[model samples]
Target: MSIKSVPLPDIGNFKDLPVIEVLVAAGDTVEAEQSLITLESDKATMEIPAPFAGTIQKVLLKVGDTVNVGDLIVEMSTQDNEATQKPAESAPAPAAAPTPPPVVDAPARSTTAEPASPPIPPTPPSTAAPVNAPTLGASAHASPSVRAFARTLGVDLSQIAGSGPKGRIQKSDVTAFVKQALTAPAHSAPATGGSIPPLPTIDFSQFGAIETIPLSRIQKRSGKHLSTCWLNIPHVTQFDETDITELEAFRQSLKARADKMGVKLTPLVFILKAVARALADFPRFNAALDASGENLILKKYIHIGVAVDTPNGLVVPVVQNVDQKGIFALAADLAALSARARDGKLTPEDMSGGCFSISSLGGIGGTQFTPIVNGPEVAILGVSRSKMSPVWNGSAFEPRLMLPLALSYDHRVIDGAEGARFITALSRSLADLRELIV
Candidate 1:
């Protein structure tokens, strides 16, 4: 039998990461790559895996302890199968190998009933778990990837009953958990006597014959997300009009060239380019409120999401590095992504990491509508159909193509004045090709 010490591996650039949960205990057998403990960093929740198959002689770590690389986590006893065949009969266990004392072992420190960082209280399985769930010492049968997924959806593992082999939780379980949480009926508040009134649930069936059709999966998912963003964010929409008379002429001139390239150039594509340029000029509009809400995360690269109306529901597929691409390139990418989105072939990555989003209802004939700012991203641009209207250009009224633009932003990050300025910049970029190029 060989006594081996398992040490923590290097985990990114973070230091003094708090141990959120201790999975294994003394005298328990574990396999290589099995998670032994979980760590919570500022950016993400991570797990430390077992080094090798062995029986734990002593666990050196506990929840709430701050750990770093090279710190001993556990002491284990490993024995080869060949050695086990004759070990007990001939060598009588070989007098367990002498264990070396670790300089900073978890067990050596004084034990506390409470963890250094207290775990979040157990939310009723009815509600979604907090994004940062406390590391409860309770054992949860799940993989590291599944745990991460649960955290992303703000799910608590202890509350879910596993459906996999040996009752292991899977990604599907997390999805089902969220769906169940969202679809569940609203529970009445506890009788604490608060002044606020609750909306009375009226039985509409008594008034008339009605059919209840459940929301589509996309609608349900998007509804929960939108509700969260709307409730949490202080939103303000600024409406304006952009004169695209010259830009329209410029686009028409390139119609033949666009057809030659097998791409149908639409005003939306030009609008995408104009918006990308606007983001570059007004950098703050290309930012998101950090998770802490204390800092702004300004993105250097512009990836804009275009909302595509599908048979099922609306989906937004992101076009990456919009600033680097030309108008034609943007048109091609937009066409491909929008087609994929409509066909339901868009992948998860296709709709993620958008610095900003554009929801255009021009083809559908809407004058202007306020768009909800996609959470994390501070703002969204709404585009309506362009109409020819008389405009006074210095001397006389002349027919000009005018496009209505609505900018909805999180008021916490953007002031009303800044929102107006951003829309003004966008209008300028769309009004002239020179502004876009410059």
Candidate 2:
């Protein structure tokens, strides 16, 4: 066996990235391509994977340590000849020098200015007067991205006790700190730009017995994201009901065929198809506001996220190219994605790049409920239980299966008229599946 030193890999142009997580320790056996450490940049988080199977001898890096390409991360003993032959293969090439900005000439100084005043003499330095000034967030250990997030929310990182490894502050830590500050007593420290009076805290155990159960990881992360979306987006929900009598019949007719094909034909698949068609008709509903919030990015492809309630919490796994797939294919995709979500086997890619979202509480019971708009996506469709209701045809009253839909949209991106029209088009598509074909 040969001992080899592993260095950080070619992780794009990022330099001095902070190590947010360390997954392995000395003497642990790891497989090839297994992740060893997690690094965070201002834009995204990435993991450093081992190149070959080996037993770790020493870990040279820890959380809160800033690293660069070619920096040694760990030492491991491996029996593979390839690992010994190319120990430095993962080392990144030297980065190119940055191009300097073009210099601009200074504006001409005024020629008719008043005469300068006489300069005063400087005072001598005192021997016993040197004082160290305290700097806000200077002593806090956090990745650059977390620091940037704190600055955006006007939060002091130093005040937050981090939950990450080695007390490294994370974005969630900043969010929780802000939430606590906002809800603290009025006499306590005020939150940045917040005017709402604080709600008084009470000891619930005094009234009855209480058990302290901490939130799951998914719940904590989703809570922070949902809170941010709720605060930042101006939401407008348009509630409407669609007659899915024909759609239900069609779905029921294909149940036997769907079973033969190894997929369940649920009403959600029909709703997915209808939403895809409506998005095609109203492109703004499938678009997102750019980071600057000035430009609208219209996506030509349609990807929808379905919110699945799991034992842990709610997770949204995306279904790609919903416009290109049939009902059977959509059902299969949903089944697989939901199963994976429930099993907690979904990768990050499975939950990304969603252009729209659908939250269905149909199987459970709800009449009509508003769902928060998943930000950057601009719109979400909430589906509730469908029931038979009396409807007036041209000549007589007829029994129809009516499905309640609540569409919440970002007011900045979609106007009330557009929101109404989009939902109406969606309703029409569901009322008549023939509209989906067109």
Candidate 3:
């Protein structure tokens, strides 16, 4: 048997990645491609895999160690010539490091038997600063991912002691710090002039039995994003009902053809096509405010995001060039994206570059509800369940299928008049199929 050293592979441009977990120990036999260690970067969590089957002789790295490409991770005993040849062949290839999957709502696996450290005392909101700020101290023990997360919430890592092994900061520690800061006494120093006052905490368990359920990772991430958008954007929601009688009839006619083509044709596909047309007519609706917030960047391409409710949480997967696709094509893309979202197989790329978003509650059932504007994108369209209603067309009342729509936009980017016009145009496109072509 030959002892071989396993080094970190080429994992893109990332460096100084923190080893969050070591999956195997010395004397542990591992299979080829089995994960040996998990490294957390600013963007995602990655697991380094064993190049070839071998028995680990020694672990060179431990949790909290910062690693880079070619950094030695472990020393292992390989059985044959094939094991020796595998590293030489795989080390140079970029594919040696597989793409990290989307972060799921799961707890990190601990390597040691040490009890979890107690929660750190909450720091005053006024003292909160970026993790890299000098006030946080250079010796702060946190992975790049934790630093990035703290940066988002404007938390100083140095103030709060870490709860992870060896005093390394974890994401949960950051969250707990923020939660405590937000729930502090109302008289506490405010971070800004317009800072929100703290809400009173009550012990509900005194009156009734209660179960404390932790929010999933996806929920926590999305909640943070939504809170940011809500606080920063001046939101204006316009509620309207669109007559989809013709559209529904048209969809029913194509149901047979859609089934033959092996795609489920849904009203959402029609709504997508209509929204794409409306976006073309109203360029501002499809534009985003630049970082400076002084200029609007109009996208030449139309990529719309559809919010899919998965078992874990809600995810919005973007459909590229929505203005360029047909109804059947849109239906297929929606089906595939939704399926992947439910199965937790969606990648970051699948959920990026959205010019606008649509949240449809029609499948489940809701009369009307406002969807928060997914920032970076100026507007989001919310669709609710449709019902038959009586409407007068100049003289006699006729029964028509009406779909409720709530259009919420960033008031800083879109005015009241423009918001009305955009939703009106969208309603017209859905009312008549030919209007989409026009």
Best by lDDT: 3
- The list of candidate 3 runs beyond 4 A from truth reads 1-194
Question: Between which residue pairs do clashes occur in model 3?
Answer: none
**Better structure of 1 and 3 per lDDT:** 3
Best by TM-score: 3
Clashes of each: 1, 0, 0
TM-score of 3: 0.72
- Candidate 2 residues lying further than 4 Å off, grouped into runs, are 5-24, 31-51, 63-73, 81-197
User: How does model 3 fare in lDDT?
Assistant: 0.74
Q: Output the worst ten-in-a-row residue range by lDDT, candidate 3.
A: 92-101
TM-score of each: 0.59, 0.70, 0.72
Residues 345-414 of candidate 1: C-alpha lDDT, one tens digit per residue? 5543566668889999999897999999877788999999999999997999999999999999989888
Candidate 2 residues 376-422, lDDT tens each?
Answer: 68999999999999999999999999999999999999999999999
